[model samples]
Target: MLGFFKRDKNKIAKDGEDHTVDSMDLLGEKAETTGKEVKTKLHFPPNVEIGQEERYYYQFLNNELPLLKENQISLSGIEVHSAEDGTVSVKAFLRNSLPKGVRIAEPITLLLLGPDEDVLARQEFNLTGLGELPAESSTPWVYVFNAKNVRVKEIPQTDWKLAFELKKAKGPHTLDLEESWEKSLADTDKEKLEQLVKTIKPPKPGEVNFMGIQSRLDDAGALHVTLLIRNGSEKNVKLEQLPLNVEDASGEVVAKGAFKMEALEIKANTSKPWTFIFPKELVLKEDADLSKWKAYVPQG
Candidate 1:
């Protein structure tokens, strides 16, 4: 299913070797604890192959299946403690069940949320620092939070939810283009697409900017928004799904939804347009004045 990373085995082998050294440095520099430390362990199953074509469908089955029966990422044996100087220490065991070839390129965003679902503190933990794991092997991770860094008023005793967001490192496209889209393009366009894929570079965070946003009502009274996004980054960006929020003048979120990009891929240093149609039923407020609302991509 993932064919992009295999294009150049020799190059990947070299990269893999370099990854080991990078992992060591990353682990040592990040996720170090200061106060009292605790230990724990977690076990995970192997990555499952369900033969599903759609990504979301696979994700649904992955989440709903029993932990023992499913090949999945698992976390357990979490321990947290606070020192007298207000430093907080956290430790947890993690097991990765993702395909053996896949490697984490970025630190996973860890969010501690309050009772009202507000984020109390956000931190990033680097799993790549531990290097690649053999399918079901376990790895322990530690995180230290200084009192001056986090926004939490006090150490959380209970009633907190930990959320994790993982982003893979920039690599070749794993999946092929949709058959319908490929068939629609001319031979020359197809060649250009392939060439772009080979030469495109990765953009920095916040490099993608919005040029314009316009909203309209469809015949069925659905809200459709047209957005012009400029790719200011050095590499192409795949925009299959984009999570965004629209807030009012007072900073209250009036509407939120993920927009599916029809074009799918945005070439580096170029501008592309995407249209999102929100069903009337999904509108959070009936009289939401979207005209003056500000739109932005929310950080995880």
Candidate 2:
């Protein structure tokens, strides 16, 4: 895992007050509908652990959306409508399962998928701009995707679905470091690595991003380069075999190698910093520019 990671700054939920806010209150200021609304009610399984008083307060919400499942964030009653402004309007009830209230300000991407699961369009939204979300309750909201984000010019009237681009983890790590790397790392290098984590943006789901740490031309005619590999997906990835081409500032290949991964597993939502050795025999250019270089997969 990327050990020298920055601390997550997500705001915590507030506690210590009894309040009586309607389930539909969060949606008033946003998700504005110009009449002609087609809303649907969802049925959910009951969680007996909910106390009576809290249950009573949520009774109205329960009739519309199922009780928020334990440790799960789900969307229900997704409806698509034509906007008066000529954009696509998507309304859905976002159900929060966390026991405590939370605020969502992160850049969230919503995808419009076709009936065959093809992505029609995607747009990013910040929920904090809309409003705060209560704990274990379903809140309704409308997302509008503009023309640029929409791929297909002719929109499909039916059989389309709206969903989150990627699922978020329940409790994300606050600089989660793998055990082995933490032990042998030096203080100065650790600080630099931490800064790298903060400086380099993370990769999207299912993709791996690499940042060069150090590149030097060895006296033995080899090029040794250290890299930080980031995996931003929700599922663990095992590198079976990775073939990479090392290119310098001129976009000229300096070194190339195929690695045999004996055992390299990058956990979900983690980054791993590693050093790859391009042997002297494999080094194609000895005088390649090391100041600005990149490592990428070679194309056939």
Candidate 3:
């Protein structure tokens, strides 16, 4: 047999916690006398598993008539006026007894259906403790929104359908948080290793004014090379003080030379130029070529 509408047995018990109020037992209309106060009490079913040690956000939605004149709502927490046995006093005036299984600290949302099946008002509320006391001097557990602000509008006497909904929030991510901490330490270690390696490196070779071999042969096989060097340092770095080297694809030094400059201040973001040419004997079309060669600019 297939069931058209099936309910989760676990969720059924949870839903029972939100709908503890009985409308018939509560007041049908506003109180007549000013300064007159009424007390309402609610209870939960036995053997229900409602948590109490944590805070939960809640709102009370009234869709039938305007619960509040304006949209302003606030719920602090339920105050205990008095308590004994398994009953407690709530300041809200109700015309009926509340439904069983209403536990404290659970998030609850109220939905009131408007005319033509429209949703009039939707609000959330949270309960925070067990209502198992009947003491008259006690207060209801704190509700987040202002109950006085919630009221029915003065339209006309019409029946409104109401229901409640509930949901929970997801917990924090712990695994990713741990990985972030490890990655941070790894970056710091890499930086330290770079500094240590640079400290023991040899100083660059002295600079030469102009080191290049101008070939008279234009055999397409002749080495045609151009090098533009920049001294990216704050101090004045002369070509005579630069330890420069050029290596081809075979790790062979195609040209290693230095140069001289007019004691130029290699101010930050500035650089000089260097041009080098290889001998025709070391230059080749396949086995030897400057195209695969490279220049290394050591960091000071």
Candidate 4:
């Protein structure tokens, strides 16, 4: 009887060891399968070639040039008169051809460059003091410079060009008005705007959380995006006009637009779904991979 009990106990131990080994094998197989699935689902976007000059030009076009073109604002009658006493008086007329409704919030920067394109002196002229630029009107801006304060061997007597740029003000919740004015934007302007928008990733509001992003090609060969947004705020929030930019894995802007949601309001601590359909023309690259694209929301 003692031998029989001992043999039964040994049999039970063997069975237990076999079961444990089988279970480990099954788990290992599952882990390997899951890894393969994840690898298959991952996608990468194509690489793009962009030079530094092209990048800077794109930024200028998007940030400063848009408003000037849209409002038909021009710098004319520029006169630079210098005296023997090292005093330079620069005068220019800013003409606005478009009707009123736009405000130039920042100062217009004028750079006096030498023949070799080296900046000799710089000046900023504020337009906000004059209030909104009226239609078919002209405003005079005068900048006086003392030669001692200038940073050049000598101011160019001839063959000089006045370079104009807008100085951007930095602060929280600052929105680029030029970007918002897209009614008269050209294709090239739109492209530059898309690129500029990609670089501006404002801090997401504490109450908002982006959950996931998915995309698929529709029947018309257009890409459709499904975004999961969660509102963690105590009060309900609206996402009807949420501006978003879609970027590839390489961090290039692929497409950008405001998202429209059927259910605009999201309850507190709840998630909502938003869909966007992008046409082929909206894509920046001809052979862009939608699988690796992500949507980014710019916060105010």
Candidate 5:
């Protein structure tokens, strides 16, 4: 037979005030506390056990640190950001009115996944030296850590999963994040867009136009992209320098090739499709199980 474990209420009050009582049980016993308009909170110590999806809360008994009458628990949100240096920044908010005795086992953990949900990176943090917080306020805690061989991790086609744990037994844990990049839209495609614009007919009015493009299906499952370049001008335009570039979804260069049309004579309204065979290595592997490949302007 197991016995009930009861805790005594701790009080925090201004000078002299009327007192009330409330009781709380740890495993399964009823505790009591005495105070007027008492507010309770609970907090987990840094050594408390936490899961991949939970948070810790604090409670008050009468006016003291350890709540003997009630147990209050809640969840907190986690935010993760990826940096250009192949590192990640993690941030979480801690409540001010946390119980002094409550313990936390783990701070945070990150799981990196491949295109098919295959885990490629896993990391952990041992949160340290967290004490009492200010009244009705939250403190933002952050950590910046590097990932090993992040080149493969930066492939952009890969998928990632993140998890967090608040406590091993009691839980209000949550895992969430807002992904952001420091670079701008133009910066994302500056190189490739530059190369692509170079292929355009010198910005001459109606001198050249991007007609259409398609991929040629080869037997070996290789891709051959065909781009149409049209001479819409009345003059015999010399297609000497055909600037072209190709990129994958994550602003990464995948393939690049160019062609030169003979001093072609286009009285008006003429077009040609240049075929480009994508290298197998540059394409996403079958093992990745990606249904479609995204396109970006190829780099020179």
Candidate 6:
């Protein structure tokens, strides 16, 4: 019952192609391609009950756009709006080529990049609002990157691109960036995260691993331990609770605790860091050698 205007296939940017989007571009259906840009106006069905904006989008997806092949999904950035406060919003389309309908209810990351493929902003979103997507159909949404979300010191006003920054979406050791942690990362911290992926071992199937990064003793003698929680499983997992043991270089239990979590999602094949504080009462040894340390689930 939805509709969209047909998109010019040639107009869609492919890899190594120019992807700058602007209002000047035509959104017409292609009837005959005789080696020229054609803006064929197609009549709309009277039965469509959606808004004019949605009607145009459906026209783009159903008639103007080419049929999607097997297992192919396409995302196109149609518009970009930048605010004086450095906040940006991008309107994009998500299309699927599957034979059957598809539904997604998970957290997804959106990456905005420059013409040279440098990252500009990274933001996380929930797919609950996407609803159900029919096969060979597209849905449009606006992704906003507020000042806190933008990562670069300079933002090119034009010629920007959009992409999904999935945990497993990108190949090995590229960037283990999740928006929550990414915002707090310093230049040195980012370099460390990039390097860690290369050296971090792959987690076993259906398992999550917590690798120790560093630990410190506060003035009050509480131990704060930072760890990288890496997920190597084929599926995304959520953690609701955590019972941990912190061991020293000599395999001595220096810190131990059970902590509650807010249903944290450890996306497939991504590594994220978190810190755990062991109160002075939970610290078994005040003088534990923490030069080399590790964390794990305490065996019964």
Q: For model 5, how does the per-residue alpha-carbon lDDT over 70-126 read when each residue is reduced to its tens digit?
A: 332211223345667677543333333323334334354544444565544456666
* Tens-digit per-residue lDDT, 16-49, candidate 6: 1122211111111122222332222223323335
Candidate scoring better on lDDT of 3 and 4: 4
* TM values, all candidates: 0.34, 0.45, 0.21, 0.30, 0.24, 0.44
Please count the clashing residue pairs in each candidate, in the order shown.
Answer: 2, 1, 64, 0, 52, 12
Over the full model, what C-alpha lDDT does candidate 1 score relative to the true structure? 0.49
Off by over 4 Å in 1: 1-69, 84-86, 98-102, 115-117, 146-149, 166-205, 208-300
lDDT of each: 0.49, 0.60, 0.32, 0.48, 0.38, 0.65
What's the true lDDT of residue 128 in model 1? 60
Q: After superposing candidate 3 on the true structure, give the runs of residues whose Cα lies further than 4 Å from its correct spot.
A: 1-224, 241-243, 258-265, 278-287, 296-300
lDDT score of model 6?
A: 0.65
- Cα displacement (angstroms), candidate 2, residue 177, comes to 4.9
* Backbone collision tally, model 1: 2
- Candidate 2 lDDT, tens digit per residue, 156-243? 6556666665543333311335566789888787787777676666677677667687889877887888777787777677787889
* TM-score, cand. 2: 0.45
Error of 4 at 183 (Å): 37
Ranking the candidates on TM-score from highest down gives 2, 6, 1, 4, 5, 3
1-300 per-residue lDDT for model 1 (tens digits): 121111222221110000011222322223222343122122222342323432333233234322321234444323455567766555434544433323556766665555566766677766565555554344444556566656776755455544453434444422234456566768886565566534555234548765334776566656666555656554677877788766654667656788776647766555554556677765666566666666678898
Residue pairs with backbone overlap in model 4: none
Please say which candidate is ahead in TM-score: 3 or 5: 5
